[model samples]
Target: MASNDMIVAIAGGSGFIGAAIARRLAHAGHLVRILTRNPDRVRDRFDFPNVDLFRADVTDPSSLRIPLAGAHAIIDTVQFDGYPVENHRRGLTFERIDFGGTNALLDACDDQRIQRFIYVSGAAADAYSPHPGFRAKGNAERSIRNSGLPFTIFRPSLVYGPGDRVLTMFARILKLSPVFVMPGSGQQKLQPVLVNDLAQCVELALGGRGLNGSFEIGGPDPLTFDALIKLMMEVTKRHRAVVHAPAALMNITGAIAESLPHPIFSRDAATFVLADSLCDNSALLAEFGITLTPASIGLRYLAEGS
Candidate 1:
């Protein structure tokens, strides 16, 4: 318990993004505490000198106040995935973790006298989004805004890194396929933000109080969904059975894929991805003083993990 050093607590810190943020902060000589449901799972991950571990589920506020105690800052990396699966470490619905969890975390932070609160949110979430997933995150951001705490809301475009689900999925497919079947025309644009750069932004967000506002962050460039697949193929040195399935064909394929394991195309995933997911990274560069690595460079980091 180094009281002199800044003590930081992170919610959902064992996952991919959170792990990166925790590791980066820990390496920067910060006393890091990560709140997770399974301490055993993250024990080895956070075995670094400056990092600590706490077993606290976001769905349960009873244990939150204790872990957040004495922390100077809190970084919430919780990404509530709606996919139904056991051993997900969280059993609550997306609404429960996304909205309710923020309130509980904020209350705990306030109780702990936390100096800064940084929330990692997706770009799709906003003041107006018809999608339930986006709406939940929007509500959570609003909750943080109303909590009277110094908060910085980060709306990062599709984050991809070594262990990111997005890039790994494409890499796996590209390794196996000679041709890829993309949704509709595969012309939808997406800005894949690098995880390391995102983690750096989070670190910067914690260092000072100036970045205490909402900002959307993305990569240096936007690429089409099909273009990304080709890049993955190039990196993997594998050619894919490239197919640009028509929307009707994708609909039929999605129906069958949805019923199977690790489908190549899901209607929900396709809808969000095939639609434009763009954002201005200027806020991350100007306000946060962090410029994100390009997608091509970031993909290299991911492909190396394989």
Candidate 2:
């Protein structure tokens, strides 16, 4: 259990990844402040002990001041709506939210009692990358590194667990469709980590000493996208014929998807599907001393109550 005196402020605590971290820290005896734009709507969602919801939007610099006041540490897991699909007209691009919002949060921490900064970045994050999401995450990482604050950045691979978007969506599709239409060649390799495991890493980082650096997080095994889909099928007990959609056609469909009020997919999303996200978990294991959960075992949640 962590010290009860510690107050951890999470910028995107209302979201999936942040909520898991918040719950983990709060349950471990830390006071968790969930910084969000809509506290009232999400108030009932976090009825757990030691959790407080504060209204704050990272996009709005002024709103962050009050919520981040006197925070012992800040964890950034802020991701914009319809993620991986940039709605530029609505100002939901990676630059504005991921990079810009992180900068705003760092600015707010200037006068505060902040001890550490933890950022949840992606495995493919690279400032020089052509992908917008990768570039934004890379830029955010660079800012955090140069902030002169003791920080631990986690570049997590594809994350899956309860309340996850990707795997859950795939499970839903498997249940309905006899043929599972996979994006691209279904050959892209991935190392998916459980959301709870990622939360555990954050908790460990907050407690451990001399653990200030970037860590690549992933599960025990690295498998192709098609293999992952098959594993999901085995777990969910839904066997469906897998059909690969050409990258070109998916790209076109994704481009069309971007025009929707709420895009479920985008051209970049297709590219993300085709990109390899493998990682070495040795560093994370050596530092955190955590035993990673395998996708085969962790994905059993899909089979429950079936």
Candidate 1 per-residue lDDT over residues 153-185, each given as its tens digit: 888878888767767877776766666667678
> How does each model score on lDDT?
0.76, 0.90
Error of 2 at 10 (Å): 0.6
lDDT of 2 by residue, 173-211 (tens): 999889999878888999999999999989887886325
Instruction: List pairs with backbone clashes in candidate 2.
Output: none
Residue 70 of candidate 2: its Cα lDDT? 80
RMSD of each: 3.4, 1.5
TM-score of each: 0.87, 0.96
The candidate that wins on TM-score is 2
Error of 2 at 168 (Å): 0.9
- Which consecutive 10 residues in model 1 have the weakest lDDT in total? 82-91
